[model samples]
Every structure is written in C-alpha cells, then in structure tokens.
Target: MSTKRYCYSCDLKNDSKLIAEYKAYHAAGNAWPEITKSIKDAGIVDMQIYLTGNRMFMIMEVDETFDPVKKAELDAINPKVQEWENLMWNYQQELPWAKDGEKWIPLEKVFQL
Candidate 1:
C-alpha cells in the first residue's frame, strides 16, 4: 500500500544531559510499549527522528487510514499518550512560532526534486 509522508520539527532543551537521556529513551526497544502501540494504532506505519545540536526533525509515513485529526483525538483520550507527552516535555520545547500546547510543528514541503 502507498503511504503519505509528513515532516515536523521541535527543539530540545539546550542541556546535553537531557539530550543524552532523550536519545537513550528513543534507542532500539527503549520507547514505552504503550507509546509505540499508540503510534501503530494511529496508522503510522513508519517514523524516524533525527537530531542536530538541540533541534529535532521527524519524518512519518502513514497508511491511507491515517488522519491527523483522528490521531490527535485518539491521543487526547489515551492516558499513556498523555503521560508520554508530559514526560517528554522535560526535554522538548515548542518551536518559537508554535501555538500554545504545540510541540512538534509541521514543516511545509518545498523544493522537492
């Protein structure tokens, strides 16, 4: 099946120790099972996050069943998802232009060749 791709970015606290801990949490099989299950249940087939300095970029590929609105709704009702977000808040910061409560700000695509 074909998938759609989305990109987003967020910033990390400028503390090296926090960055290291964040990286460790995202290491292979280290993410909370609840969080992983929630992502798969949301129709996200694949996702990757990359870090440079204190900035993070994420790429996500989702199946046709995926809907961002529905995903957000689902997350809003899931305690585990809320827990993960709250915990991650310790290491993450909203983009300068992000609205209140926004963490990962979607990136507009440009110059694709």
Candidate 2:
C-alpha cells in the first residue's frame, strides 16, 4: 500500500484533556468521516492516525491519480473541514517550529520497514 506520513508536536498544557478529546472524537467517528470525505474529494485514499509520545502522525494511501498540490488547494477552501479543524484547534497549540495556520507538518521519512 502507498503511504504518506505527517508529524506534529503538541504543547504540554492540557495534554490529558487533549488526548481525551482525540479519543472521544475518534470514538464518535464523525470527525474521521468528515476527514475521509475531504481526502476522497481531494482524490486520496485510505488514511489512518497514530501517536507516539507527543507527536501525532497520519498515514495515507493516496490514489494513483491524486494530485497532491491540487488536493492541498481544495483542502484550503473546504468550510466544513475548516470548521472541524478550528474546533480541534481549541485544544491545539503551535509547535515551536510551526508557522501560523499550520497544525501539522509533513515529515520526511528517514527510515521505514
């Protein structure tokens, strides 16, 4: 399967609450459905999220016909997706290396199995 990875760090404040919210959001499934719709609309395929310590990661299997730049452009104009992001941002903080409006950064893979 094709894969892509994204990584981001979170601020320590309200860490427990943030984790709880992440769990709850996933449990509800609506958040994920919304996200998957966005991805599919952008021509991407299956995706998943994982966490390790303070970092969050996303793995996506992009459609062979997907255009990454176009997908990003479409993502920028999606109001409902933006609304979801804004809600989550309530519990999110800018990481030390992040610029404004960036919640997660695309990570370069150094090694993989």
> Per-residue lDDT of 1-113 in model 1, one digit per residue for the tens?
99999999999999999999999999999999999998998899999999999999999999999999999999999998999999999999988899998999999998898
- On residues 31-66, what C-alpha lDDT tens digit does candidate 2 reach at each position? 667676887876566766676654566666665667
How far does residue 44 in candidate 2 sit from its true spot (Å)?
2.2
- Consecutive 10-residue window with the lowest summed lDDT within model 2: 4-13
Candidate 2 wrong stretches, greater than 4 Å = 1-14
After superposition, candidate 1 runs with Cα above 4 Å error: none
The all-Cα superposition gives candidate 1 an RMSD in Å to the true structure of: 0.6
**How accurate locally, in lDDT, is each candidate?**
0.96, 0.66
Q: How much is the lDDT of residue 4 in candidate 1? A: 99
Tell me each candidate's TM-score: 0.98, 0.75
Best by TM-score: 1
